[model samples]
Target chain A: MPEELPPLGDKVYLDSAAAVADIPDGAVILLGGFGGVGVPENLLAAMADHPARELTIVTNHAGFGERGLAVLFRQGKVRKLICTYAFHKSAFVFREIYMAGKIELEQIPQGTMAERIRAAGAGIPAFYTPTGVGTQAAEGKESRGFGGREALLEHALPGDIAIIKAHKADRLGNLVYRGTAANFNPVMAAAAPLTIAEVEAVVEPGEIAPEAVHTPSIYVNRVVLGENLELRSEA
Target chain B: MNSDPKLEAAALTPGDIARRIAREIPPGAAVNLGIGVPTRVANHVEPGRGVMFMAENGILGAGPRPAPGEEDWDLINASREPVTAVPGASLFGHADSFAMIRGGHVDIAVLGALQVSARGDLANWTVPGAGKGGIGGAMDLATGARQVFATMTHLMKDGGLKLLEECSYPLTASGVVGKLFTDIAFIEFTEEGPLLREVAAGLTAEDIQRVSEPRLLVAGTIGTLTREPEAAEPGA
Candidate 1:
């Protein structure tokens, strides 16, 4: 009898480093996270050791404290940051480099940033939004009137690679997230040409219900196991 | 009004401003509370009001900070503080979450401000000399919400007036603020400009105007602002 094949062609990778080994220098990386949650810490650690340089990171905020993206920022690997929030009390690493004029910062309204990324994934070239009309954020952008209100044109924000974290994933790379950790992962999963997911667990192909999948298998290219660093409050 | 101890003591506390804003939120409104003082407004909304709290980080029907053992780091608000989800909460990704905000689905946005002009212009996210501070969601919230309510102290830390004829700081949005709740008064921005609606219990209309750079139009019946007793602590 012929050998039976694994269902759905397993996309799971046992090593995080190997999953992200081919990311080129100067790549535009879509990192998924909002604050400390939903960050691919293991993948970031791997990238920190990888020989990539001058990467352009796009995310919600600069990394909080000394973990995740901070590791990349500390190593002087990033060339520019495209984000909504760049400086926070704990984002010392980003603040230092940003203050020293060593890295470039392109700030946009949070909603605009999210929509631009979504547009990239959905194959929309650009869209108009009323979120920054008449403000400095609208400066230098194309403007048109819509429904009697002014709107500003924002372009799509695409990425060469995406590194996201999820609570669980099937061997086929379908993912599900826990609570708000779902923030940018799903959108980014579709926005990048090469997508890598760091998940808490990788189950068999049929383990995760089809309806429960937050990110479909088609958008993900690789999956690797990562530690759950969720902080526990003192009871 | 140069930092008079007596006036400072009489000014409403941040808690008072939050409660005042909470009372004005219509029942069943989908409200987005900005970080800091605006976040406290959620704690003061009366139960059964059916107000849905939306956090920009991707949760609707956001609830209070989770009880000690129940906290989930994955469940956090815009401030990145661990939070809980109300029973009927819905979670989404960043794109969809922001769509609701910029699409005018959010009824109200309660935000903090650095300065507010009489014409309802808001200056919040950054100071003039301060190096590029984070923009976050302020511009989106200021421009997209059906109504924008700002909460801030009446005076700057150095005794400069925050209720100005025109904001000197860079604006978050032009003519976006619908109402203002400060430490000393409640004011509304109308077609006729700023209308002083209420004054703190210990203050008079003149006291408010003395510090306001804009000429406030006094309401026909200016109500006295009062602070109700604090509610029981959450998760106590």
Candidate 2:
């Protein structure tokens, strides 16, 4: 009764642009990174050049030091951003556009933002937290007392696409990250409908040790190998 | 950056303020340091004190910035500045890091403040006329930490007291701050109000009171905060 699934081996994309070609207008996307580490540079490069418009970007911060996401923001592709840290020391472009009211921002607490994405990946619909009790963040959210403290009910946030980076990816899509670059990438890889990874190396199935795989292959849908990845533009 | 030039000369140096806060960190306490001046507290922490540093960016036991030419770009603090992991450091995903914060696993949170009310309310995330600055992890730290310490200068550049009877700026959390450390003095919050605990060298109770917006109480055991023995004297 059901159609057979596509062959599972050799999931590599020819290039970053080809990997993200199917993302249409008005889709909600999750970008995996904190500051600049672990960001999918080649994937963001592709998104910057793609014709998609009015997209909602959920990221930890507007890309820092590097011109990765800021390039996309400059090109006027992002319609709304759901982020915890929208302002960075080097975020002049994002600040100018935000101040001009050209783009929308839904600021969230860094921890809550991370948990919301993690919850979606874990199949949890909502969770309660005491982080925003009695603050402006709890203004419209539902709340009830838990134990002795009041907790705000927060919903899980799912995305249409998750663009993440890893140090290496096996042909099976298992991933591994380096040091602090592992911050949000693993959780995001499982929280979206279409999980696309831009990794530095794509190895054979047995090359990536099973113990080192931070993201198991089941959650990954696409893999793009990034060659000579440069977070900043040459120009 | 201060609008008030009159009090600019009297402020304590950022390093001295960090030393003052570091002295309060008890051994074995897991502390979260907010961005800006609070990050400098890592530099002033006495070595082998066993005070663990937590960053919202999923790093626990974060050490000082890496040595020149030894920097690892992937190992950074919440400020995105390169740092080394201490001996017991553990790296985790963002969700677990916030779980430590929101779940009250963190013992202390030292944060920079724009304004602190006499009622112990805080407003440090954004300026009044400035567009919404990112909240980051302040709200979570303010609400979740067992104790909150606000490290800031006593007065704004405009000479306005940051320690106020009521904060005019947007609030980060209400009744969350337990202690206040400024260039001029150390004030502890009580049900009755802010009680002055220690004053910097040469400044009298009257001098501190003049700049304080809320009524400042001279605690029965008020002590003088001394400069580091290794440093030069004021105006030296």
Candidate 3:
């Protein structure tokens, strides 16, 4: 007789707080967003109240106004930031903390940062590109010649956890994003060991067409219903 | 401001520079407009030209800024300003968006520059004394685009020449700029040197040479640069 298999449990959680409850201190978090879009605002709010400290966050921008990542920075929960753009006019919180030398920052080119995270998800160790050759961005990095041009070696960037926002998700954790809001969520979803997604709505598994899914359920570990935050374009 | 008649007449407005650059773009070319003055190029491109605007933050075929109360937070440009998507537009993740840029699929990149060398070296990201500024996609766009153009003022506020023999600011990319459009002149970088192509209506070649640090080579008759009148606002 064949061995009996255990039943599979649904990935849905009641709220954002419960989804992010297990995040420990000193965790490397890959945050999915580009400016104002694709940010997991509800999950970030929950993290602000959580006791986790000393987090190293990887994202596109540091923070916009006084919400989202800015709130976490104001609370002293973030220890380091790996991002492309760090100092916008409204990102006063990150700028103040960084100027005081209270936090660490590693600035990467926008394209290179995206590729590094994508490489981690694709299981590639490292790759070479000609984006930052002969500039300060190439300092302390290995170089080689290819096709009569020089390229720099960039390594894959992995994270301990990935927190992302999606437009919709199935109970099986399949995700779909709306418009430009898909910016960094798909890449971050694949680069982390534990991926928690905050979605506006949850549906049955068959509700989402397989071909229309932006992120497959295999990469997502959990999904929770998030409050619909007001959408503004200033950030 | 104490300004000479010749100096005042030679100056072209920011709109002139943007419209001049827009006329140079061929039909059906994919263009990436950098922040600042270059962003205005999109407003001048005639409709139905099939020109596509690529925003580095994962948008292709980006349209004009939306009217008030019609802005969608999910739809924005690289500058994080709310914009509309043109017909047949497509959206993707950051990885694929940058792949389109770094892979050299973009035909033209129009960027604003702080300083540009005669040899086409570009330096615009950060100044020497200024604190760390974001690189964004400038380096990738500079190195990957088939042709790079820079739009900037001809002189600094202190009356210093911005077209230099060598850039004082940090280099965004070396020998990437092919064409330059300034408030006073339009020039092209050739293998020999920079060739003066056009000048403002009241300025002569000698007048341009006075402000430019590097020697400008003039061949044939120089054309006068002029801006077309503004088009009527849509839905007005």
Candidate 4:
């Protein structure tokens, strides 16, 4: 039988020192977050530590300073950062590298990025949004009307592997996430080719009641358990 | 102020008025700058005090101006204008970004204006000649800002002054305007609304009135014009 997503544990360690994606170089990783608030921190750290290079990161801001996706930029692991909002809090090192043309960057509007992530998770090929119709985001992208007003049609994203975070998970792969971390994890978990999550606690199967599970056991692949959650860590 | 002046020592040129507008904005305020002349304001924001900027397309703590040959193609402004994301900036989803604007989080909004009548109705972004200017977050900012400031030429594109009895275009936010920094003079919306706040260094009230299409309320006390930003000169 063809494998969908792996049903692993709800609770797993999202430690960069422990386990994470073994993504081959030149792979596309769809990063999910709206600013650093919803970022998968531990997963990001693991990716940073890994030896992989030439990554095309699909993210909004890619984080700023010494934290989040900016670390990847500092390491030169990213070949491209495909997203918007480069003006507000870009990492200093990332800016220097990008200015040097050491990497390729694809800019998308803030609104379009959000809708595209939603589209990928929902299994839709493409959807139109009224956000970027008349501006530069509409450049080369197709435009159509939904309710008389024009909206831009953005393509859905399918990644080679999906990394995410959770607050608590059962051994059966059921997950529950806290506030801001809860933003993109469920959808990201559902849309990737391989979905791995790191959680603070891992309990026995059925230990987490069906009512409390944020993500069902059907979508998860491998579960790495870590005891203490890093400051806002995820896949 | 009534029109009809030949020449005077206090009259300011259009360029000088640009200078004055630059001095009005504070050094560090979380700003959502509107397009057109307001975009020019970013170049003048003093470097390094950490002014957090918001672009509805999803950036916080946005940087100002890119160094020559340093433009990050993957990172841009709400206009998709090539820009550099500042240190400590973060990118996120559109919804969360808009939440900041709609939630009254931005400190101030500086935008361009097409018309500012004696009664301060702002007409910018779209003027009907242009198709669907896409309000984007302009409406959110106009009403959301702790203060709404505008920068524009004193006249219409057809050589007519943009100052009018009231705005000809659709209103974005009624009575939301706090100040008007123009190329001719510095005006503000007061309890009386759209009162003449200040005159340029080399300009007089009568000179301002002559160029303005509409009548202006003269300031009771003569005020001085602000100086344009130094960064604007470098880019220009």
Candidate 5:
């Protein structure tokens, strides 16, 4: 912690290394991304070199190729993965590790995964949803019939911290996302005890319109620039 | 998309099965298409129709794939394939999108199948004990949609019937499939049991029966299935 803060409503700007320094080993991390979009790239790069080990990562998909969470998996940082899709065409690393019994996996239906995270943010302990009633996803869980159909009991999925990406941020840490990059970032920010956001640019408060902010400043603890934002491909 | 080009020449292709299912999509209905054979339904939806395409990955009003070299990584589908969105498109998070589905906002969901039981129980996400078995979103879509339509080949590659008396594989959902469109026939799951609605051209009702383990009920108005849009009567 620093001795003196910059000013009221000014989020502490940290370099990638300092931003990730507090995340301890075996932390339950909520990662914001869908496919390759909206991934906290620089933070993940920092994590590649960081000493945090045996992490439990919760995200939408098992990342493909050699980037994002796949890199974390490759570095042997992930102990367990809780996600929606464990198998996809781009899954090179997870397939090898998971099949070899080197890692643990808990596959939740996509909607159920999102709702569980959102439920944590909303301070709800549990809710009944019709997502995985009769499937393997509902195994060993309590279920009841509602309106002549089964609804599975799902609990909240709170996390120690959320590392997310956004397009822009204000000094107050209000965020704005570009395109479909908005998928999990907003919800994950609210679901965690601490939230670190990676942004393309951080401007003064008045620069971003009030209503345009996708994630309010209160949910964010720190902000880091992704560095060389222009080179980041939107395609 | 056909993953196997060698099987493309095989009759009752995935595309052909998709076309048959596309005709059942009522105009102005909000529809969700699962990955695999059902994903091709977006290509067959008639333009300017009021149909709203929903993807569980948080997109509504999703359109067909963009022309070559015009891909937008930010605008991809649930399958992670680059796609375009129709006018009035809406982007949301996974929770909201599935809320639309489970809350009964979506009118129809078309899915691929490994096995559809006589009672409409569906198993598509896995081959029993396969290392790659993962359910994804099929369980949600199966239980959520107002109406569910399954599209796939009638038989497995080894000449085994996919329409069965009971699902031997793990089920994605139970008693939810309303209809099934296959390469060889169109079948409906009713309170009574599996009803054979229509058979493909040059194929007899007995041909489908020979492969089916469940007793199939032939529809009173059963006819040969056709691809020409005009061949289907308006709202037939």
Candidate 6:
């Protein structure tokens, strides 16, 4: 919303993300996905062309071998990662983060993480829950009595641009998400500095229903056609 | 109403039941101890049994307490308390860790409970407006572990029962728990029903019968709750 970068016609909007080749290294990025599903492979591949090193990432899954947002980690672009489950990529992500002491990683309890993100999106500011009151996750965190047990105040996540993939989007930017891909994209779109979505198809504004829209156009800034439906369905 | 036999003991303290459940575990078993009373079992396994403790956040073979000057800053269990790993223990992530539990690789799972219903319905997981459900892995373990046991105080306040003909608490697993080890008695669950093994010392069967919420099926014979070993006195 800056005067120089009014939401529309902003120079930052490279006709397609390819217009600018140099993104500042070590930038914080939030990706949406679980495993390989909903991954923005084209945008990720585009980002990979440049050596974006030491980047901090927020995501749900580490992806499977070069498929999930983890391709950035494999490319050695991520310096830190915040996630719930990394079982699929633990051999590299866990060992390197916890064992080898290479990158800093924070693993959130799954259900708690889901609620925390939802809380942030809902503008609750701060709230307490008794989920991780006594476990290791409780270390270095303040806990207060709630009801009869204890709850901890886990801070809401603040991100740089949040990048997501959705099934389709209208020119106005209202989006539709399909299948397993809905994991973290919807919540994260509103929680970041900027949300860029890559869609399988783009149609006119009225094509999508007002209620069927998972993310309204206000939350989405830019949309790029990444792949055709016929080609995407094959995968 | 039915000729119940579990009310076989005299009187039992909370700590007595905790210690009894602790002793029941054999050494070298892969164990997942649930929160609350069962967590205390970490202190009671037999010596030199090579017990491997597992925490859901991906630690295996965790030892009770870390040795002096041996604390590694990075090494900790799900509780985040300083801990030592048993010999040959290694690290794994959530998927592998859960696969270990659900894959029937774990030998025993000890859980805390509000109630073990007559039909063996476990109601532990609590929902916000619904009640309590830490659910963690309790649901998976109930049906997965080779042995499942419950450790808790027998009766709730207000003269109510934690063991009922049917559970009032939300059930995580149905008919999967093997034993109910409580402050007052020992019960081995079966298709025939909960057959009582031992009762608290000093309390008569009549006293227990009056307190039991459901009609507990009686065992053919009764045994006395075992006393702590002689060496246990000095430590106390």
Best by lDDT: 3
Better of 5 and 6 by lDDT: 5
Superposition TM-score, candidate 2 onto the true structure: 0.92
DockQ for all models: 0.63, 0.53, 0.69, 0.05, 0.57, 0.03
Measured over the true interface residues after superposition, the C-alpha RMSD of each candidate is 2.5, 3.1, 1.2, 10.7, 2.6, 15.1
| Cα lDDT computed for each candidate against the true fold | 0.87, 0.83, 0.87, 0.64, 0.82, 0.62
Q: Give the TM-score of candidate 6.
A: 0.49
TM-score of 5: 0.91
Model 4 is docked with a DockQ of 0.05
Q: Report how far off residue A221 is in candidate 1 (Å).
A: 0.5
For candidate 6, the docking band is: incorrect
Q: TM per model?
A: 0.95, 0.92, 0.94, 0.53, 0.91, 0.49
Interface RMSD of 2: 3.1
Model 5 CA deviation exceeding 4 Å by range: A1-7, A228-235, B1-10, B227-236
Query: Candidate 1 falls in which docking quality class?
Result: medium
TM-score-best of 3 and 6: 3
Candidate 1 lDDT tens digits, A27-131: 999999887788888899889889999999999887777777888988899999998987777778899888888899888999898889999999999999887
Name the weakest run of 10 consecutive residues (lDDT summed) in model 3 chain A. A1-10
lDDT of 6 at B25: 77
Q: For residues B91-198, could you state the per-residue lDDT of candidate 6 as single tens digits?
A: 543344555665578888888877887766666554234111234445556656678888766776554677888776656566767888877788888788777777
TM (chain A) per model: 0.94, 0.93, 0.95, 0.83, 0.93, 0.82
lDDT of 4: 0.64
Candidate 4, residue A190: lDDT: 72
Cα shift from native, residue B158, model 3 (Å): 1.3
Which residue pairs in candidate 2 collide? B2-B157, B3-B157, B3-B158, B4-B157, B4-B158, B4-B159
lDDT score at residue B176, model 3, on the 0-100 scale: 89
What's the lDDT of the predicted structure labeled candidate 2?
Answer: 0.83
